[model samples]
Target chain A: MSELVDCRGLSCPEPVMLARQALQETGNGTVQVVVSNAVALDNVTRAANQMGWQVSVEEEGEEFKLSIKK
Target chain B: MRDRLSIIFAGAVVGLLAVILVLQGNPANMGFCVACFIRDIAGGLGLHRAGVVQFLRPEIIGLVLGAFVTALYVREFKSTGGSSPLMRFLLGMLMMTGALIFLGCPLRMILRLAGGDWNALVALPGYVLGVWFGTLFLKKGFTLGRSQVQTAVNGYAGPFIAAVLLILLVTAPAFIFFSEEGPGSMAAPLFLTLGAGLLVGILAQRTRLCTMGAIRDLILFKDYHLFLGFAAIFVVALVGNLFTGQFIPGFEDQPVAHVSSLWNFLGMTVVGFAAVLAGGCPMRQLILTGEGQSDALLTVFGMGTGAAFMHNFGLAGSPAGVSPAGQWIAIISLALLFIIGISNVNLHRKAKTKDYSKAS
Candidate 1:
């Protein structure tokens, strides 16, 4: 099953780091990350892109949904 | 090591400071104010000759020795430097100048408000606003560049200076400045003050306590390690102050403070910006200096030299109010910060372009 990681209220490099760490630990899985700020969302997207993971972002008001697959 | 342990350490340090302040007759929020006390020390050493505020504070000595001892114990003491040290020194100067104009460091400003000094309330928002702008610059890719590892002697320079200052404080040398009256004179006893400073330094070192870093971390990376420490300090200090009967509520005529709301806010705005730019609060900078961060050391010297210039040029504010010269310095400093941001952004853009070209 795909895992969801809600990183809302988390700041830069954190959501990114958390997502990466989770993906590594989970070892090839789908993950969804929620970020409260544009910067964090952008950072997560960048990290996902860099890691060659499939990513889709959903905007829900002030929050963002970043889904990634490895 | 658990992160919770760091918070406990910070709480203990705040507790120790409360005890010290209670013993010394300082108001509850009066513990561990590097900027305020240094101003007093400046007057005590006859630097500004501000009457009624002269006192040779033991806290500064304590902070240096405490951090130095802890760093030694942890084997983290590595002296290195040779970065743009002089520039750091100048920034430190601007930092102190701005802080004095505001009448407190970020920690003290928060502490002051927690103790019910509404004057600090005015400064707090300005600080956050300044940090916000700094964050924008950071988002735009502004950086101070990298600091290369230097010989151990470079780090020694700061401690050596601190040691000499301590000796001068004790000796009351003619060349060294002192204030005859003002907030400088109203100081806690020597040993107790130093003890409080040492405890703060040790805890701060262990926990990486920094008020500015706390705000910045929350703003930048949502890292709570530093902010938690800040919260602990405030909570502990608030309780300590209340128990000690040092909690005086009101904005008008708080001890060692002024009431110019606009300048108060703007002053901290400058401090907040500089602190974020420099990567730590004044106390953090001092601890880093002790721990062999040459850049931090340079910032300390910058503060001291800034103090000298502030007093010499009549730029330091008083309970009376901010000087025109002080106002001008703040404006110029802000302008310079903007210029630095622009250059750093341009450089980052260039780097990104080159990297992209190579990758393609």
Candidate 2:
């Protein structure tokens, strides 16, 4: 299984940074980012898209899991 | 990138407006200060009895309206809130306490420095230090949590208030106070001030210009993108000051300024620290409010109330310097900021989650 990026409880740009790093490191396949808030979800989704990745989102409880792929 | 550089141009325009407003009749070195204007607005609304600084500033009204219009036009307006609203309100008050202690917001701080006010120099490091401290909290995973999307009416409230205030100013309602002396008595033409504010609001919203963000970005990522905007404001305003003969670099005899070094430093330190937790500066708060964020609206209310509280309790500083009470307020603000910053962070999450940065 691919490693998950747990960006939960992190502030604004931190979650975005971690998500971007995961995307860059994986270089292919899929990466999922779990964020505790919508702001982080938006930021990470935007960052991933900017890097030319496609993202699908799933809301689980109070957190969101963003699945990103090339 | 060309897009990032646009903020610099926007900052330059704002700087030019500051000088022009002064030439047109704003207080010396007081072009567009959010904290001062909000305080004056509070006094105008009779929230406080500060007679010398009482007027419904049209520039403030224009800022909200302009950003609201621009946000709507760009389809960027989204109504959202419910992330620690009460806490944000108090943090807003904390931010205002700092600004009042220093007699200016971050925007006004840059303008003060541009006007060759030596006092701003001392506040600069303090402000930087505050942002730095905020970065530490960020490193430890501090967050105010997520905000949920709200209905359209929620987003319209802030702009609606601004429009109402504009009408009140034009009609000269009896309920609102207008100052006969001191800074409140000084003002540019209503249309002119409002026009400048509108222009700034539109530009700022488009460029995402923020004083706190400028410092935060530099420290967090070593990215100087936002710093360009900060430098542009200072450079443009400084040159304008020189040509207009407003540049007088000294600690003494500066208009509406204090010579106290320790208070000035501590005051900005409070401002910077609280701003990070709150997610924006005073001007940014206004823009966010215009963009339909209820949390930002609460912060705005906090600032207005804080302004009233400062005057009512005799805690705001003047040219003479901060009172013992105001100094204590400053100290309390820092302590409160520390509590707020530390309490919100869930560092235990860090232990459960693996950092993605090591993936490389």
Candidate 3:
């Protein structure tokens, strides 16, 4: 099962940090990170990419959901 | 959709945060200002003998420390330096000089506007114009070169220094100065301020929220992503101020502000230009320094020194108006920034032409 990390109301580094944590703890599975801002979206994407994860993004209303898969 | 929501959310959160700080007694309409707080910090360190503005701000220290901790935990801490450190320092100093003349940085400018200070309305356009002008040079291929990766110790230095400063603030040593009165003497509770700083630092580092970058990107790339976030701050803050009975709109007699419209505009113009040249706003520079960018650390120090110079030499304006010396400094700084922009652009162009000639 994919793990979920919701960082919608949080700002930059928090979302990025949460996303990183989700990725790290989940090890090899899929991790879904939800964020609300462009900065968070961009940073989370960059962090996921750096860890060699394939990422897919979805727009949910005003929030973003990033699915990172190993 | 998500990007838009995130920007707005970030903006609203910051706005609300600023209002809360103000309500909690962090100076009227002067909540969460990086430049002003840094200036106060400079005074605290006895970098300047300015009695009225001396205080070790926990927010500044917390910002650096917060960013440092987050960067380390995420393994994004890469110590780097040697990217025109002196130039960055000069740009930072110039940036601070401009901000002090205007009595606030870009963040405070927006906060002031949110709190219904019309003077900020004037300064805003000047800031935008300055950033637009800087973008012209950027399009012409102006660059600050690249930074090389350094050792871990180098990366840790900024955060280490910040940590030490936090200790000094806590210890209240006799040598370190503290404001007995004035804006320097005013602040929210220490723990609250530190927490606010850490929270802002983390969020800013993650999202790369920068007021100057918001303007630069909007002008250059027609990108509204970052702009939307900052705009949200204004909107949210305005609403919060209205609700809290803090909204007072007019041109004159605003708290901690002057009615000198021309200087306010020109002063921020200098800031806008220097921030662009330095590749980030003051807040962004602090975040970068925390993330182990040595060049940015130098810029932060330059800002501190610039603040000291402003107060010590009476180049900083008050609610009364800009001093004659401050006016002269603003004019000179503007000229210096333009020179730096033009020369950098021309030098790059010349280098490109030389390379082409060699190829031919």
Ranking by DockQ: 2, 1, 3
lDDT per residue as tens, model 1, B66-148: 78788879766766555456656766776797898888888788678768789888998888887777777766655555454
**What's the TM-score of each model vs. the native?**
0.77, 0.88, 0.82
The TM-scores of chain A alone, one per candidate, are: 0.86, 0.94, 0.92
* lDDT score of residue B297 within candidate 2: 91
Across A1-70, the per-residue lDDT of candidate 1 in tens digits comes to: 3346655543333455567666666667777676655545655775666667988988775467777888
Best model per DockQ: 2
DockQ: the better of candidates 1 and 3: 1
Considering only N, C-alpha and C atoms within 3 Å, which residue pairs clash in candidate 3? A12-B203, A12-B207, A13-B206, A36-B6, A37-B6, A62-B2
lDDT of 2: 0.86
- Report DockQ per prediction, comma-separated: 0.04, 0.19, 0.04
lDDT of 3 by residue, A20-63 (tens): 66677778977777765555688678667767899999986556
Least well predicted 10-residue stretch by lDDT in candidate 1 chain B: B351-360
lDDT (CA) per prediction: 0.70, 0.86, 0.82
Residue B228 of model 2: what lDDT?
89
Output DockQ, candidate 3: 0.04
